[model samples]
Target: MNNIATPEQVTATALLLVGYAAVILFFVVRGALRIKSMADYAVGSVRFSPIAVGLSLAASMTSAATFIINPGFIALYGLSGMLSFGVVMPLASMISLVVFTKGFRKHGQTVKALTLAQWIGSRFQSTGLTRYFGWLSLLLITFIVLICVGLTQVLSNALNAPPLPVLVGIVVFIFGYMMFGGANSMVYTNTIQALLKLVVAVVLLTSGYEHFSQGVHGFLAKLAAIDPALTHATNPQSYLFRDYFEIIFCQIVIGVAIVCQPHLITKSLLLDNERDVNRYLLTAVLVLTVFFSVVFAGLYARLAFPGLQLNGQELKMDKIMSAYVVREFPVYVGLLVIMGLISAGISTLESLIQSLSSTITSDIIKPLLSPTVFSGTGGFRREIWLNRLVITVLGAVAIWLSYDQLLNAKLSVAIFAQNGVYAYFAAAFVPISFGIFLRDAPRLAVTVASVTALLVHFGVYYGRLTPYMQLPVRNPGVSAALGIVAAVVVGGVLYLALHRASVPEKTVAVAA
Candidate 1:
């Protein structure tokens, strides 16, 4: 591929590219030689320490979306846009550390669960639905790949892609790296990438802080200059306010699923012990700090170019941060920013691919390998080889899908899937937590959780609050919040009912 980038930019990006490749390659070779069984392919023999689990968990999730776009959302909606993440993430971290970690270890089930759909089905005793979820999970994963391509475009646009062949080759290389090594290697790569993201974000923030002195104050002045209603964040007097809130939960659907996401779950499951959850908490804090710092750079751009507004029709707000950096920074610094986005993008892509592939094989494929005929160690080997094959095949499928629908699909679907990932786990999180702590919690409660979360998704998301009572309610978060309440209400009520029913044998004792 012919290099289109200025030599300085190319050298900077190339340095990052080579460094990341070396780390992942080492893991890939180590994993292949060491992995003789299917379990090895999926989970690292479930021997990962808390540090690895926490760091890996953090690395896997701090994807290009956060590195590239989420902070900008914070800038756009102020703190309101951050609500979905702000509300969900801390809860998610806790759930991973406290509630869900020990169960995988106790169940002695395979740890590297490939797809949440398959994992949930298997956990709930619905194996037949495995592939159905495999298909849905693939749908979601393809959405992620599209985001990867879109972000690649944004980055290359910043670098001013030298040519089409080079761009295509760049995408192919990132995909190929993950396909070769799978999740284990992706973990190592993500760790390195996550650190790089922090460094780049800090550098830009330190350099750019002077530009956005007014913060919210400056934002108000700019908003007033542009249009007076910017202060009324909640008022639907304008199209901008109306559309922003309307489409907010459109992102949440997948955000809810994020917790249940195969790759994210692997981070929690692969831990050595409960002690390491704190490390994940620390990682989460560090990542968000850097993320916000980067966004502030764009916010500063607002101060520098007070008239700056992301044009929805011709330009993507998603691409603005990169654009700002490229426009402002000299060649070398600009190169680092592009490389950071690429690294984050590649990390997210690899995790989704590896997790999806592993889930299909472990949850959907392995069980079928010997449905009525349970085999021993050799069976695991046969199934694992099948997993590697599944990885190759599905990775290819994702790439093809990316090439086809990758460009045309709404960035929101990918962003929504990326952001709203909390739903998947929310459906599963509370029920599982209750089951662990409360003696009276019934299995039916778990069922209620799954159903209510799904319904909540529709009701809050589609403006259908209740079958009988629909209002002009604007809270996009209401459905998920209420769904959680419904789960607890139903679960709690059922527990009391079951408890009361079991307590009334005093008179019967006398009769006996």
Candidate 2:
């Protein structure tokens, strides 16, 4: 009844994972040698190719959620989950990435900004706002927890390891190495991970092909036989995909602004030349299309377990895909899939640790503790050491949060992650948009917009102000979308009014 791996399969997966770790460690150590200062640690010293950066972007953006947790959602909610996650979200996010990357990177590279907070502060010329965002960056720790839980789920299910020990081992190994290697190592590892993920994506997407032997309609019939809602575009009984608004509109809005995050946007800054931007975006969008499609594998899992049980044991949403992989694939193929899932989780985890630690060390801690953190020129050996200390603290925090989410997740850890992650990008959306497009945006306008987004997003969710949120299951994406819309409207009006009033003062002073 239990979802478990056989001893032979577990041994094979563990051995492959160990080999994978050795290969990753080799690359991490190689990249760590390049890290002589905080700058190098933050953005890397090596001149990486556009294709590699693009692959890294794909890998980082499509994390354990796409490969692991999302499938669980699809398995649980059926057709509605697929439409929302696989179709609506991917279309919006890819377009947003292509649209936002050039403008953000142009400004980021011009100012030599290392973090998202730095980009905002430099763009708007507001130290207070930058510091505020640096503190707000703590919300992203929730996402780190999601990835940690996801990695734990995949490993525990595959290796037959207890959750606590597996969780501790994962935290220590990943966080310990992350302290030494930053962006330089992250890009290298992520690129390799992306390549492996591509292979697994094909394997997973095709694994369900047999179910379609009776044609598309037949496959639908099979799903409908299990549960009629499984074939419907809208599952009224489910919390997440109950209506068109939750499935499509909310996802589209959130997707458009999702690029505002540091890990996703700052990826463009890694490229040395502007000409390579097109190639980078092209490669990323193409690869991500495949990565996103991997969510459909959940439908296959559902078909495999029509009753959602093995013997008499019920399958948890988060463990569905892990259990599916172990039950369906051959030992070698399952091991490859497990490695791919691990790669998917660790790729983004590395980026989070890199960006968040740098944000804490460079923007928050240094400003508060000592003004001369990076000092004259680039003699930042002290800053480099400080960054390692920051990573240690972040690692500890990640462990604490991950443990809590694993034990007390509501349905799945994705909700907890989405609540925090969505709120962050919602707050960031207004300022980043204004900074990129509105040349004359006053600091007051951007600052108010950012603050308003934070208030509106959290207010709607916690207060259950919106109808969508009042339900037993609430969608954080709805709150984020509404907050983004509110911010744009309020901030736009304020900027226009402020700009109109300030113009006359300049003219009067010149005439006098």
Judged by TM-score, which candidate is best? 2
Cα lDDT for residue 416, candidate 1: 38
CA displacement after TM-score superposition, residue 427 of candidate 2 (Å):
0.4
Q: Assess the local accuracy of residue 125 in candidate 1 as a C-alpha lDDT between 0 and 100.
A: 55
**For residues 152-178, could you state the per-residue lDDT of candidate 2 as single tens digits?**
998998888888889889989999999
Error of 1 at 240 (Å): 9.7
Q: List the lowest-lDDT window of 10 residues for candidate 1.
A: 238-247
lDDT of 2: 0.91
Q: Write the per-residue lDDT of candidate 1 for residues 172-263, one digit (tens) a residue.
A: 66555554565455556667667777778777677655434778577556646644543443334421123433334433433433455566
TM-score of each: 0.75, 0.98
RMSD of 2: 1.5
User: For model 1, what is the alpha-carbon lDDT of residue 276?
Assistant: 67
